[model samples]
Target: MNNIVEAKGLVKSYGDFKALNDIDLTIPSGAISGLIGPNGAGKTTALKSLIGLCDVEGELQVAGRDPRTSRHKLMEDVCFIADVGM
Candidate 1:
């Protein structure tokens, strides 16, 4: 099975704070998955990085395209819905 989403050695930082540290993930096609964690656990950061909403280090690919370089094209195939606050 090929991965629909793949990340290796993923890292995301904000100034002096590290939101994500060395995250490695893979989601096979047609598989269901979810991310669960307490607040500030880097869950949001990871999602943001996957979709190219934030800058990230290491290798990341979604649907066979690099998120960092093909963000707009990637968006055509993927959709992201962040939490809404009132």
Candidate 2:
């Protein structure tokens, strides 16, 4: 089994507050995954970082390409949907 998404030592910060602290994650290919947490728990931050919607620290790989470096290319294969009425 190979990982379709991989994050190692992932960190996201806003000012002095850390939205995400050293997050390490791996999702196997063809696996269904979900992120569940309370408000301000870095769920959005993590998703944004994975899709290159925001700048992030540490390493992130999606489909064998770095999200930070190949965002345009990555976006070609990735889709994001948000609840506008939420």
Candidate 3:
């Protein structure tokens, strides 16, 4: 099956702290998934990156499009309910 979301070597840093470190994620198409972790565990940061609300290093693709460049188009197909989504 194809992936609805794919990320490789994802990283997000805040000042000197690394919120996300070399993260690799994959969500298969038509699958329901969630991120679960304690506070400050980069859950929010990951969501922010996935939804195109924040910028991070590495390659990421959602709905077969890069969230950094094709965010407007990606939003049309993917729905993320969090921070800004609320």
Candidate 4:
């Protein structure tokens, strides 16, 4: 399957704290993928980058578009649901 999400050498830092570094990942189209890690593993950061809520360094793509550049266009396709009711 073609990759729907791709990130290479992703790096994010706040002040002196590095939240992510040199991370590479790929998610193919029509595939089910899961992210598992302990807290502060940058899972939320990565997702936030995908949705363009946060600015990050390195290459990041969603549906073949840059979330940073095409945030307004891509945001419509993303849904955020609260888990409080679950």
Candidate 5:
């Protein structure tokens, strides 16, 4: 199956604090997945990057378009709602 979301060497930082580093992930089409981790594990940062709500380094593609440049296009085909972590 083709990947619906892809990230390689993904990195996100806030000033000098690095939240994510070299995170590689792939999600196949029509697959159910979840990001599970403790707090401060960069789950939120990774999600933000995937949804194009945060700028990130490295390669990222959602729906075959780069989230940084084609966020509008991506959003046209995607929707995300962020809620407090349970």
Candidate 6:
């Protein structure tokens, strides 16, 4: 199955602390996936990175588009649970 979200070698750091390291993720369309780990395990960081909430390093894409460069375009097809939707 093709993936709606994909990340390769995803890395996020705060100063000297590394929140995400060498992370690889793939979430296919119409599939439910969960991120699980101990506290400060980078789940939030990864999710934010994918949704273009924050800038991080490494290759990341959403729906076959680059989130870093095409965030607005990608967001059009994405929905956040907490946001008002129509």
Off by over 4 Å in 4: 82-86
Ranking by lDDT: 5, 3, 1, 2, 6, 4
How much does candidate 2 score in TM-score? 0.92
lDDT of 3: 0.90
Q: Which portions of model 2 show Cα errors greater than 4 Å?
A: none
Our tally of clashes for model 3 stands at 0
Report the poorest 10 consecutive residues by lDDT, candidate 1. 77-86
Write one digit per residue (lDDT tens) for candidate 2, span 4-34: 9999998889999999999999999999899
TM-scores, one per candidate:
0.92, 0.92, 0.92, 0.86, 0.91, 0.88
Colliding residue pairs in candidate 1: none
lDDT of 1 by residue, 4-40 (tens): 9999999888888889899999999999999999999
Q: lDDT (CA) for every model shown?
A: 0.90, 0.89, 0.90, 0.84, 0.90, 0.85
Model 1 local distance difference test score: 0.90
Q: Report lDDT (Cα) of residue 35, candidate 4.
A: 76
What is the lDDT for 53 in model 3? 86
Model 6: per-residue Cα lDDT over 1-86, one tens digit each:
88998899988899999999998888999998888899898878888888788788888989998888999998899975532331
Worst 10 residues of 4 by lDDT: 77-86
- Tens digit of per-residue lDDT, candidate 5, span 1-86: 89999999999888888889899999998898889999889999999899788899999999999989999999999878779742
Q: lDDT by residue for model 3 over 1-86, one digit each (tens)?
A: 99988999999999999999999999999898888999899988888898788899999998899988999999999776665543
lDDT of 3 at 67: 87
Clashing pairs in 3: none
